[model samples]
Target: MQLSKKSRYGLRALIDLASAPENQYVSLSNIAERGEIPAQFLEQVFASFRRAGLVKALKGPQGGYQLARNPKYITAAEVLEILEGSYRIADEDVSPESRCYAVSETIQDMLIGPVNQAMETILGKLTLADLQRSYQERATQSEDMYYI
Candidate 1:
């Protein structure tokens, strides 16, 4: 299954949070501006993440959202599921009389299962800290470059 913009943008937002000081609240505007995502969409996406207990929103003078758990404890799969629902490719419902039924089932078992499992394995193992580290490396590499 393809990952939606909500999943991609929201993960970037989370990476911003993961890069911050431990549990420090970060404003939506800041995240949106940095991530180049729409503020309204971010609010909805973050609300879902908050409801899933992946994020926390604070109110008052210094108010915003922060990770509910440490970055290392948060996996990309969790965020993906929270934002994009199940990533698995399900078997289509086919009548037994249909000519493609048997082949379809075999494809689902042999192809979809293995591919989805591989995706799940990577996402489940990749923590937000890992993504943030990747972002940092790219940022560093960009910084090291100079225009002649």
Candidate 2:
């Protein structure tokens, strides 16, 4: 299934925050501009993240948002779950008397189920710190290439 805008923007914003100087409060407008997300939408996403304990918002002039925990301690799956609800592929109960029961069951068991598990496992294992590191490496390579 495709990721919704909420999850996509939220993840982008989180990565931006993770890449920022530690303990620095990043403004929502700044995050929206840098992450290319709309300010209003990012605000909504941050609200969910705040409720999920993924971020903390501060008030006043020198105020903004910061990660509730270290980037290395936060996984992509956790962020996705907060933004998109449960990431489970599907587990709807169907009638045993349905004509397509066997075919559907086979597809879920053999294909969808295994793929979902793999995706979940990968997402679960990937933390924001991992993404920040990758982004930094790419940025460094791009800089070096341009300089050369």
Q: After superposition, how far is residue 21 of candidate 1 from its true place, in Å?
A: 1.4
Q: In candidate 2, which residue ranges exceed 4 Å CA deviation?
A: none
For model 1, residues 21-76, the per-residue Cα lDDT tens digits are 98589999999999999999999999999999998999987999999998899999
TM-score of 2: 0.93
lDDT of 2: 0.89
Task: List all candidate RMSDs to the true structure.
Answer: 1.2, 1.6
Q: What is the TM-score of each candidate against the true structure?
A: 0.94, 0.93
**Candidate 1: clashing residue pairs, number:** 0
Q: Rate the local accuracy (lDDT) of all candidates.
A: 0.91, 0.89
